[model samples]
Target: MTSNSTTYEGGCTCRQVRYRMTAKPLFVHCCHCRWCQRETGTAFALNAMIEADRVELLSGEPEPVMTPSASGRGQKIWRCPTCRIAVWSNYGSAGDAVRFVRVGSLDEPDRLPPDIHIFTSSKQPWVVLPEGAPAVTEYYDTKKTWPAESLARREALRAKRS
Candidate 1:
């Protein structure tokens, strides 16, 4: 979704898991893998990939579930206990350094639509991708192709770190 500002707010079904994203997403992706299908109980998973530092929890905490990773380690997944809605996840390898928020849980549900699809090899045969949408058999990092505005924000952050 297009907006004048980068910030967006979201919460769980019961509104008990409010959160604020302080910046625009670095990238958006649609995951068609079986794992995502089963987890979301949908055809695909839409994610607004953002900097972990830009996400803030503004309400109640979510219950944590640690699921084993593809490499056998565990990753912490946070969800709303009442709705069992997956709110966010702390990717295992980085040990809670980065997170992937479930864009469906956002208050502005229409704000971020997937511009690309990941794990297309596992997509259901009946599901057709949109014309001109980029698809990949596996994951693609966004750093190489972030939109101009987001790239500038990332560079500014990097400069601050240095």
Candidate 2:
């Protein structure tokens, strides 16, 4: 992690599932997919994509909730059983090893902002995406996707900017 890159500390509602991410996020996003809406019990879900290795579990283990994805894949949502708050999710494919952390569940939720708005086609009409954000009407994207090297580069850039 770069010096200027912020270290984020967060946990579930009851603080039973604490976590720390040493590096800056790969990307932040507001997803408006139907699954997100049902799962989050909100119009959308705020997510911070980060390298799996950089995230450390500081406390209790999260209970897993398995659900089907839009692509017919399985998604395992990890949550704090005490608070029943979804903290992170793992995509089913063995080839993909990243976990999507729920940004809102963090201790410092404001450390990051949604840089992109995804699944806009399912977005609620009343909710307008912030101006200048990258918006997509469908599933799967590249602009907000993070590769390891790119993530490291972004961390460096963040340090320089800070």
Candidate 3:
């Protein structure tokens, strides 16, 4: 488990849009849905889900690009204007309350591994998950899967929005 003080800094490939995560993310997801694979052009998209307030932009601004999503509600993918590298995404369900930071964009991407793998039903046949990694065909209930601290943090954020 990561400490609350843990911080991470990252940027786009061109270094035009730098940012920092002030604390550990609420959760990390490795999504293997077809939409993710096509969007990222990879087997999966690894994201660190955290409160939007925790992400601090340190450099150039990222332009939000509206994109179609599996939910059909769509999502906003923040990408660097220079390199057009996706840095993060704000899903329609969570709106602006949360940001799914791209794990691959981090300076030390390996530090935050996926807490769980979702949409594994559509995962590429060639990709193999770790022995003990938490995974599900679709999604998991946050109440049952999320750590207590993360749940509390999410509740606090919700309270603020009220």
The parts of candidate 3 lying over 4 Å away from their true place are 1-5
Scored by CA lDDT, what does every candidate get? 0.78, 0.78, 0.95
* Per-residue C-alpha lDDT of model 2 across residues 39-145, encoded as one tens digit per residue: 88899989887657778999999898888887788888888989888888877652124668899877778778887788999999999777877788975555346
Give the C-alpha miss distance for residue 83 in model 2, angstroms.
1.4
Candidate 1, residue 105: lDDT: 83
Clashing pairs in 3: none
What C-alpha lDDT, on a 0 to 100 scale, does residue 11 get in candidate 3?
88
* Residue runs of model 1 more than 4 Å from their true location after superposition: 1-4, 141-143, 147-162
Residue-wise lDDT of candidate 3 within 42-66, one digit each (tens)?
9999999999999999999999999
Better of 1 and 3 by lDDT: 3
Question: Which TM-score value belongs to model 1?
Answer: 0.82
Q: Candidates' TM-scores?
A: 0.82, 0.82, 0.96
Error of 2 at 74 (Å): 1.3
Question: After superposing candidate 2, which stretches have Cα over 4 Å from the reference?
Answer: 1-5, 93-96, 143-162
Candidate 1 per-residue C-alpha lDDT over 63-130 given as tens digits, one digit per residue, 9 for 90 to 100: 99977656567667789878877888766654554567788888777878887899999999999988
TM-score quality measure for candidate 3:
0.96
